[model samples]
Target: MSKIRKKKIKKTNILLGFICILLAVLLGFILVTSYKSEQKESRHLSEIADDQQSGIEDYEAVKERAKELEEISSEEAEDTEDTKDTEKTDTADTEDADKTEDTKDKTTAASGIVCWGDDLINGEESNTYSYMTVLQKLLTDNGYNMTVINKTLQGGGTLSMMKMAGVSDETIQSYITKHQQAANGAQLNVTETGIRDLTEEQTTRNDMDCIPVIFMGYYGGWNHDPAELADQQEQILNTFQNKNQFIVVGTRPMDGSVTSEALDQVLSQKWGEHYISLADVTAQPSSTYEAQQAMAEAILQKLQELNYISKN
Candidate 1:
């Protein structure tokens, strides 16, 4: 055959072998790169899954805590005949109440007042003289045994106040939750008043047979819609299990001046003598201890005038 032909064939074979090796190396590098990419992507997805799981756990825990804070107990029903007719026979009804609200009644079944309000009514934890507290003290000092059960907290707006007052209506709760500003004392900023001793008596929830004094309207405008807030306040009054004499106390609006004025007028008209305004008691109602004293005096005066308590 031919030596040159054999050598040429051998050279072609060598070239083909080199090409095969190069292709194998390139394929291995591509597979290694693909494996590394898959690993990186898997790790990223796992991290995201873990973070989402943690967030869900935190959210569930917060929901549980909120449920606890909003729990309301059913109060024992009392002979609330005196509370049923607050305005119909104002002079006569309260005259009868006076007999039961005096010293003898104190020794028998102590008088109670369930107060529903905001920071102004609850005051701060540091000051023990919330309007309800001071009003209770004033009544006790004046020969009457009165217990004011403060159902309120700081930043507690009308909606949250209603929730804490045993209101479980879904539509109402949803409306408030969506509308109220978180920064204000609307929801989640709840703190309950501990059982306290007033003079010789320990105060208990008197909702079963007690006067409910509602002093709301602290959060508005930037905090919440003043009109909606007023509506919520009205709704709160209806949540009472007993149809009792409920006092509606109004506050000076924090913001939304125009709507606030309108709200004030509407409240006054609807409630009539059953309503009281903080503006009438103080130039500017506040959470201050002094303001609370003024508030107490105002409430005491109202009770005396209404014959809810003995003028003597």
Candidate 2:
């Protein structure tokens, strides 16, 4: 082997080694570039996945909010319905109450005679000659209604007669209890108290639509002066007029004294059609049953004349 040949072989081996190194470096660079590109692609894909997840969460949240809104609207509708139903019930109750009040008013109007006077008007054991019984039967037969209130006392005069007119029985009893004579001989001035009480009662009677029929002079007992009796009668008429009440004046049948006749004349003159003459109706000994019936008929005729009842 020659030295020159050996050296050439050595140089060739070195050159081949250098070429191999260059090829290895190029392969490493290609691998590194591919790995970097893959890493970048993976990062972009991860970001896209995150964005998709966020979008899904937002959509779910929107659906949940819509469901909440639907629930709120449904509750509001239910509340509105309940409010309307309550209003309807309240309106119905008000209508019913108004109807009830109207019915009560009608019933009150249908009942008759707010006030009346005399001992005959008081309740007692019935006899055929009883004035109240006969009058009641006559009025009922004529299709007329009568509500009588008796305010009679043993010694009651014209002033004390029917003093509690239009007042309830309980109230009249209470008033009587207060005005009764004392054990020490102190007695209430019956006439003055009666006038005052009657004035007060007139105010109440004015509100009730009914007639006030008064039978006077039984308690006068021929004691009261004729002129004074006339003046008192005039006062009564004026008071009733002031209260807007129409009065029906009548005389007692049994007490046919001069004073009674004079008072009847004055009442006839003053009251005209409102005056009822018991003497003209029935004769003085009217305690008989037939006389009482005749008296009731006469009174009924007078009421018919006044147009308080239909003539038919």
Candidate 3:
């Protein structure tokens, strides 16, 4: 009887130890699975956070862009008024006006540089007010008869818009590459979709055929691929045939989005002598008008070097 009892007790002890071991193994497996699941969830949450941050940045950009557009519109209204006044004066003073018109016609018939750009170069807001005025001053001062046609204060700078307006794919591609490389091998954040808009809008203008050179510049709010940009540059060069006659001047990430690389590369290629760093423009940190004058001086110097002025 004693032996039987001892054997039963031993059996019970063995059974309990086996049960404990099984439970421990099951518990470890559950813990590991739970830990893995938690890790996956954490990673997913991190991605969501990153996307949210990007969305916020894009939202801010859009808002800023809207503000810029409103300002530009007001300035444009003022310009229209000024233009109307000038037209009235010209009509009243026909003799003098005719002489001026004739001279301008003659100059156009002779030779001149046609300049153009997107909002960064032609915005209506105070922050962007001086681009054209500065450019015009530079051209006139340097003796080049210049005609500027500003298009698309809001939606005129994308590649798709350019294609719709008749700018060649080759031209668009060339512009992108040139801009990216000009920005110094830095990955241009501009997307391919909007790349051709500015070109198309510019080409569609009635004045497009008249301008010899296209001046294109932009700031932030878009992503332009560097590889695509280089290809576009090559295409433009091939299409234009005459660099001296149909030169394309471009400044990338014009809204302070791009580093100096884009500007540096562009200047090094076509308008190296003509290139002026934004620093030069804002040397004294003066009013928008004063800074524009400074920019004008640099551009004027380039025009002079180009021999646009008559010797008369």
Candidate 4:
């Protein structure tokens, strides 16, 4: 009876020990599974944080690039504006210069003939009445209105006769007879008028008003002494001054027979470069068409330099 009881108790103890071992094994498995799940969750949280950080960096970089682009656009706009302003300023300056030139030309034209000279060159021969005719042609070619007064007198080159207020009886008789013959008695009742009876001032004024007046005459040569040439120049200047007109004097060349260095010297001293000698003025054949063309060209050049035309 004692052996059986002892055997049963031993078996019971062993069974209880086996049960405790099984429970311990189950608890260990549960703890390991829970630990692994928690580790996975932590890793996921770390990955999410890293992604957020990358996104923030990208956003900041984009903002910086946008600011840079804005600055570039603003600078481009300013450059465009500056370019336009410069162009406008240049245009204004050009216009101002053109206006100034126009004003100067108008003033000169309104002042009448400020300067005049004889033949542009020395040692030149010209028809007395045709001198102004050539000048008129030249002026007209150069876009100026030019008409010449036709006057017939004994000395075509001298202004003395034209300036004189008195005429001889013989000259008056000759004029009347010539007119009577030209009429051929067709107008027998035609009245005979004496030159002395004519109004000098009124006739002179009428002649001056009839055509374009040019102060051109032959002087300063063997025909006239230095004193005479100087006197003539002075007289013409004085006369034209009173009338407010331009005068032209013809000078003899130093190389010509009547070459008086004195006249040139005086002219150079008093007139500066305004005087022109017949030699230079009529170097080309005086009677030739080519000479006429050359003379016209020279005069046109002078007018252009004096700002007579619109500036290019």
Candidate 5:
């Protein structure tokens, strides 16, 4: 072919590629814009449906659809809140849960509470509320500006939790391999409806420093060993590197022998006011929805006493 013809072909190809690139960029912009708009509209509708906002009298169909969407979202959050929360009711049943992977980083964002623990914290899968779920609602309803992060492992025990924190020995670390998904199906749950993103203000507040809530359930075997359990509890607590940035929650003791007397004593004594035991909060620390609400209430009370948060 002539050099002129060759030059023309090359130019045609170059122009076509540029057009294709332009088209791709335009398409991507359109998709992202649409997604963002939909999200905004959805949020508006949800605010109305949830009765958090008003003045939509002319948009009855939109209101109805929003209600349906809100209901669906509520159901999804309820159904999968298990992050095998399938059996938080019985300790024996907890062994069936399978979890892998770690939470990735313990150096957290300071805009919220980081809750870590086992089934009791995870709550039962069928139930609508884990303590984190209840806590999120409580904070929002009571006019607090903190997010609640649920990092509970459904069947995770003391050793498993230690591994998640990367505080335990290599033996235990190799044993669990990776941590489980959270009880609420998402690693970070800010709402009962599912995981929600943090606001820019919430995320950037005070340099992303987060308050850690430490709550670990016992291992399945011979969970009645308080002294040994106390030592394990101590190990996990020390890993936070800053005692002042976290709160420790003692689970309902295992038959009052395994946890209450020995476990709670060790934690409370060492951590002093930084610790709160469910034993003091409730004689029954069952994982029912109501019980979870009670747990959230107790946590809020403790936060008030600590002055970690205050009503706005």
Candidate 6:
């Protein structure tokens, strides 16, 4: 081989080697930059994943807190309902106790007697001294605590007459005046007193505990129709039941020849335990002073039994 050719070949080889080295350096730089960029991307992705995980954990915690709050609310609602029920029960019990106390006080503070009847109780035949006086004396002697106000009238009709009259101040005043006059030993003209006045006085008084009505017949005789008398008596009794008054009923003895068995049955059926038959105490159709006294005793006993007056 020629010398010049050999030298040229060596130069060419050296040049080629330098060029390859330069290419290799550039390739290394590119690879390093690419690797750095990949690493940065990977780190960014990891941060995003961590953020997603934290968000999921936060959501789970929020859900748990909401559940806890719901439980607390439910418990509080139940406690409120229980408290309301207890309060209602306590209020009902208090009301019942108050009602019972009021009833007891009313019974303890009760007083006064309103005597209402016909000539049998008005002492028309006994010189203006009737069974009412006997009853008052008996009650006073037996420790009965009350004021007796006699308002009996001569020829007083059925209970219906009293119911129809109603209550009035004038009637009450008249009775009070008569009572005062009697207390002062003034002779009273009992015949002038009407049935209407007696009934009005009975209905007007607020202090009376008991009012016993003795009915014989209308117009001072048992000659009236039995059915008509019974019906009127029934009406009066029903009306009196609606009133704020305690009432007792009594029947006077009629003529033995007269059929009073029907009337007695009606009184027993209508009044039940509140009825008193004077036939058992007196045999005479018209009551005498002794009979009136006996009737007064019976009336007092009946009042005690009916709880209108305390049995001492």
Number of the top lDDT candidate: 1
Per-prediction CA RMSD (Å) = 28.9, 14.8, 33.9, 20.5, 37.8, 11.9
Alpha-carbon deviation at 20 in model 5, angstroms: 99
lDDT of 2 by residue, 1-312 (tens): 999999999999999999999989999999999999999999999999999999999999999999999999999999999999999999999999997777545433433433344454323443445555676677787777665433233345555543433334454344344444331356444542354434454334442344445555555522334544444444444434222334444554334445446667766776777667676776654445665567667666765664555322
Q: Which tens-of-lDDT digit does each residue in 188-249 have in candidate 5?
A: 21111122232443222231256777776543311344444555566655665444556777
Compared with the true structure, what per-residue lDDT tens digits does model 3 show for residues 88-168?
A: 888889977887676555433533444433443234553345555666655665555565444334423445434434557
**Relative to the true structure, how large is the alpha-carbon lDDT of every model?**
0.63, 0.56, 0.53, 0.48, 0.61, 0.59
Error in Å for residue 214 of model 3: 4.3
Judge candidate 2 at residue 83 and give its lDDT: 94
Judged by whole-model lDDT over C-alpha atoms, candidate 4 comes out at 0.48
Could you tell me how far off, in angstroms, the CA of residue 86 lies in candidate 2 after the best superposition? 57
**In model 5, what lDDT does residue 295 have?**
76
Candidate 2 — number of clashing residue pairs? 0
Which candidate leads the pack in TM-score? Answer: 1
Better of 3 and 5 by lDDT: 5
Q: Per-residue lDDT of 35-93 in model 6, one digit per residue for the tens?
A: 99999999999999999999999999999999999999999999999999999999999
Over 96-181, each residue of candidate 4 has an lDDT whose tens digit, in order, gives 99978766655344322222233333233344324444655666665665344433232223233323313334543554565466
- In order of lDDT, best first, we have 1, 5, 6, 2, 3, 4
The Cα error of candidate 4 at residue 231, in Å, is 2.3
Q: Is 2 or 5 the stronger prediction by lDDT?
A: 5
lDDT digits (tens) for residues 44-130 of candidate 1 = 999999999999999999998877665522121222454555555897777778865663444234246677767653325535777
The residue-level lDDT of candidate 4 at 159 comes to 31
